[model samples]
Target: MDKIEEQLRLQVYLARCGVGSRRKCEEYISEGRVSVNGKSVLTPGTKVSDGDEVCYNGRPVHPEKEHVYIALHKPSGFICSNQDRDGRPLAIDLLSDATHRRLFNVGRLDYMTSGLLFFTNDGDFSKLMTHPSSHVEKEYVVTTKKEIPGELMEQFKKGISVQGEFFRLKNYTFKGTRTVHIVLEEGKNKELRKVFLSRNITLKSIHRIRVGNIKLTGLASGRFRKLTPREVEQLKNQALENKKNNRGKPKR
Candidate 1:
């Protein structure tokens, strides 16, 4: 019997073509920007075979020959996106000399927040890292414009909700009068800034130092390096482990 040809979801195909992560490609499909064989593809789940012609924004695309995973020390003031309409710098630009593949940041970090960030051309890895069930730990060092407020730490430790967004700290340690190291697993958007702002505290800086088992120990600011094969495997194993541990539990 002849083996059946694998059929891939349209969005997954787009991601293999380096058209951003699978989630981002889904958005592209929803916006009517993707096409198959000259016809618009509005559904992300639409399946296509290897022989089908796929186009993105009228340009044909194919899967990348090799997958690249990069760890970037994104500096403050640079956006994570590939393009910025306001002329702001982009973090992906730092890797222009490193590799030619279209790499998307696995998860986002705000322009003002800098540190360990992952970029990859593989969509499955991106999905695994960003999926809610993974619950991968992210460590950050937050510095305040003034002495770190006592109430702020207490509220975070005890969990607080402002404007319907919940803020909680898995663990925290005071490194200095105005600095604290905090770890979070949920990693909501701009969570640290939101928590600080809720208590009328101004943040001087927010820097991420770790994601799962990957640590930003010697990597310099505004530089990037390819992830070791062992590191990549460890990340996958850790996320899978976390997903297994959190099975049937509600996201907090």
Candidate 2:
């Protein structure tokens, strides 16, 4: 007999096992990579409960005992990929002392940029923070090699298109002669770099400092810390609120 409380959708169960986000797990199901009770299952909402053997990618999977959310101060030159063909240093490697769970980066920081980044085994949390609909704000401290012209800065605020991709800052303010504090809602890949390149502005560096309500404070470079339960809930609530507020808005 399956207990009602213990039964969950197959995709959700795989996600809890640190396989990937629910949507990714659903893809695996559709590809016939998941099975239950010795039978291949290709349904998204198939019920899974205790006493039923589950396998993902031909390996048995069970929900992790505890879901972990960690904040890591990633340093420059570290790749976010768990495995890279180029043999670059990995940011997730810094958490070798943290835990043995299969943790994945919530969102990626590029190899050259560094600052507040998150790693977690919780697929739901990862999806919430990274989904475009959530509209979570990411703050960055951008330093240019030289002072940027007033006109160029204004153009960034007005938004510009480079290589057919739009780039714009939600808000930006001058921090100093060569530094600007920038906030982005989309955080598109290489967005800042590409825009700067388009205008011939040489960037000295870019460091992310915030994600939604979570700020990069007191965490040293190359260090990691566990997120408090309260912080996790607050972030989730913020994402939900952002999603609710942006409902029906056209995607960029």
Candidate 3:
């Protein structure tokens, strides 16, 4: 066998190639689902280089030649997953033009939720935006079946506990009797729904509008556009500033 050059851990290589998260790639490796040069590898630590062919689930995985960053207005009923177990539509499937680029969503939006979503081939950028310490703000427009009580609004601002986990909104305002605009720094899974459920509030819909400084304005549902260079820089700056400001603080 030829000696591999520029060797990297198999999991790291998979992540850099936009296959999945490093930890997820580790799971794939441990399950004997990854191969290097035609041999299945069960060790996440196995090293491979540019010269070796890598495959996942019998399909080749290669690093993207150019990074792509896109903002998608995800429509409801599409899942934020690369592969859906139940055969539901995937969010990335909507990016028909970039299917071969190996792009992945940066953060997730539940199947029932809709709005601003980011897809990127840049793993480092994904890590920065999704990291808790970055404290990037995500804003949502929520519509409830009934008017939110004044006390519940106060609880939202002060923080509420649901299922033993505490969640706080950075800010919230009533757009109408049944609609509210809420901002959050922590992107916990189904956090908005969980919080509302805990308060006995029946949520009709939740639509995300913004992340950091990026807004969902002008984008139609199920459509996407490449992010401008300036937009990308602004997002990175926001993450860096948040990380600096929140240093030494506990991550929620």
Return the top candidate by lDDT: 1
Better of 1 and 3 by TM-score: 1
Q: Which of the predicted structures, 1 or 2, would earn the higher TM-score when compared with the native?
A: 1
Question: Lowest-lDDT window of 10 residues in candidate 3?
Answer: 1-10
Q: What ranking emerges by TM-score with the best candidate at the front?
A: 1, 3, 2
Model 2: residue 35 alpha-carbon error in angstroms: 6.3
TM-scores for every predicted model: 0.94, 0.84, 0.89
- Residue-wise C-alpha lDDT for candidate 1, range 1-252, written one tens digit per residue: 112179989898888888988989999999999999899989889998867888888988888878899999999999989779999999999999988777899999999999999999998899899887898889999999888877778888888898998888889999999999999987888889888887788999999999999999999999889999999999999999999988988766
Tens digits of per-residue lDDT, candidate 3, 78-190, equal: 99988878999998999988556777888799999999999987877888989888889999999999888878878878978887888889998889998999998877899
- For model 3 the local lDDT of residue 97 reads 85
Give candidate 1's error at residue 40 in angstroms: 1.7
Error of 1 at 83 (Å): 1.1
Clash-forming residue pairs, model 3: none
Off by over 4 Å in 2: 1-12, 22-58
Query: Comparing 1 and 2 by lDDT, which wins?
Result: 1
